[model samples]
Target: MKDRKSARTKETIVRAARKIFSEHAYHTASIRMIGKEAGIEHPLINYYFPSKAELFDAIIREICEEFAASAGEWFDAIREREITEGFTEFIELLMEFNRHNPEPLRILALNLTQTKDFSLIPGYHRFPDLISRLHTLYVEKIKPMGPDQEIRMFLHSFYFLIISFLGAGPCIAQVQGMDPDGEPYREWMKATLLFIFLPRLKDINLPRAAAREDG
Candidate 1:
């Protein structure tokens, strides 16, 4: 019972911290603000998290873990089988992840736009593995043209596509008289991303034989 209570308290603190961080960005967000948002005393927050930096680190870890798990599942699913036209479904899964986790996405946008110090964010330790896993998956699916750099560019483009749309938010969409969170816009983004990537996928060089493999 005590452990459960503690867990709940920590979860509440995290929820409040995510909202405050999204609204104020990391540097501007304060412990007092998070405490108030969580309906807990500021000291309670300090008891759970030693400092604002630690709290922010916790959030980053949580976000990274969630993304790693989701992406890992998709990676495992396509390990043996080719992605082929399953790219559409993959894109939709990414969109769905962002849709359900807008707060974390907003927090990430703040980190990207305001600080840009990715080192401060947690979960990057898994990045090398994530990239390696993705390389294997893409190598199987696209059978890329040249070297790892070509594959790296493709992966970077995929990252940018997801970030660009998620970072836009309602404010950016409103400028164009569109709703970023709406299903119509999501479908449009999905289609646009697919249109941009499908040709590249199709144009990629076929897989080299075991003797000529460059990966």
Candidate 2:
């Protein structure tokens, strides 16, 4: 009973911390605010987490673990065939997750822009291995005529573009002269993704004249 109670308390604290950190970011969010949100005393946060950095690391680790577990299940289901479709489904899942939990996405953006200190997070260490495994899965699925590097670059660029588009929603809207409000924005985004992935999309011919001159 005592261990169960402790687990509940820890979960409550972590949930509260995630909410607060998502809004105020890692450096700006105080333990007092987190404890208040968690409905516990301020010092209780210290009792549970030794320091602010430790708490932040714990939150990131939890998120990464959850993502890994969820991805593993999805990957297992689609391991046999049609790898491109599986990859597309995975991207859609990530997009839906970001749309639902915009706060965590915001927190991630802040962390990337402000902090270079990813060494404290265990997830950072495992991320490369995870990427490599995912790439191998893709290679097995799509027996492309191009080199492995070419295929990897194509897939990586596609997902990276998706992430950047979602992550910089405000800036993209501003640059594109579109309103960042309501159903129209969502529709526009859906259309944009469709256009990018359409089989009939045309390629732009770069100025080979310049390359020839340089050569």
Candidate 3:
């Protein structure tokens, strides 16, 4: 019973901290605020988390774990498909994931762009090396869109753009007078992204790097 109670208390602290972190970002959020939100005393919170940065790191790690679980199904959907189809699956799965768990992504975006420290962005260390893996995969799977730098630029730009979308999607939809949390918004995004990128894919003309090796 004591262990169960301790586990529950830890979860409560984490949930409260997640909410507070989401609202205030990392620097501005305090242990007192998290404690208050959790309805536990600040000292008690210290027992569970030694420092505010530690708590914040914990939350970021937790979010990564959350997405890691959801990402499996996404990979399953796109694993054997054509490049464009896989891309489509990527978009759809992310959209669906956001539908259910929007807060974590918003928190991530808030930190990624808002942190003043360019040297080490907050929560930057915890993320996996997905960018490098994706880059390698693109080299093997798709034709060269341009020189290596331009292709990398495309990937990097799309990354930040997608993170922005994941974070501020509701705000953007609302600005355009649509229901941000509704199906119409989802379809609108799907159509919009495809319309913008699919044609670019053709124009960019990426040749498969694997064929170069074969030849």
Query: For this target, which candidate reaches the highest TM-score against the unseen true structure?
Result: 1
Model 1 compared with the native: what TM-score? 0.80
Order of all candidates by TM-score, from best down to worst?
A: 1, 3, 2
User: What is the model-wide C-alpha lDDT for candidate 3?
Assistant: 0.73
Task: Name the regions of candidate 2 deviating beyond 4 angstroms.
Answer: 73-91, 116-130, 136-146, 167-183, 197-215
Give candidate 1 misplaced runs (Cα > 4 Å): 77-84, 116-146, 205-215
Flag the better candidate by lDDT, 2 or 3.
Answer: 3
What lDDT would each prediction earn against the true structure? 0.71, 0.62, 0.73
TM-scores for all candidates? 0.80, 0.67, 0.76
Model 2 lDDT per residue over 1-215, tens place? 99999899989999998888767756678999999999999798788888887888788766656655555665565544343454456556666766776655455545555566766442355445545655665545433444567556665565456545665566676677776444566567766665665332111111222333466
Q: Count the backbone clashes (under 3 Å) in each candidate.
A: 0, 0, 4
Please state every model's RMSD to the true fold in angstroms: 4.7, 8.2, 4.4
Cα lDDT for residue 44, candidate 1: 94
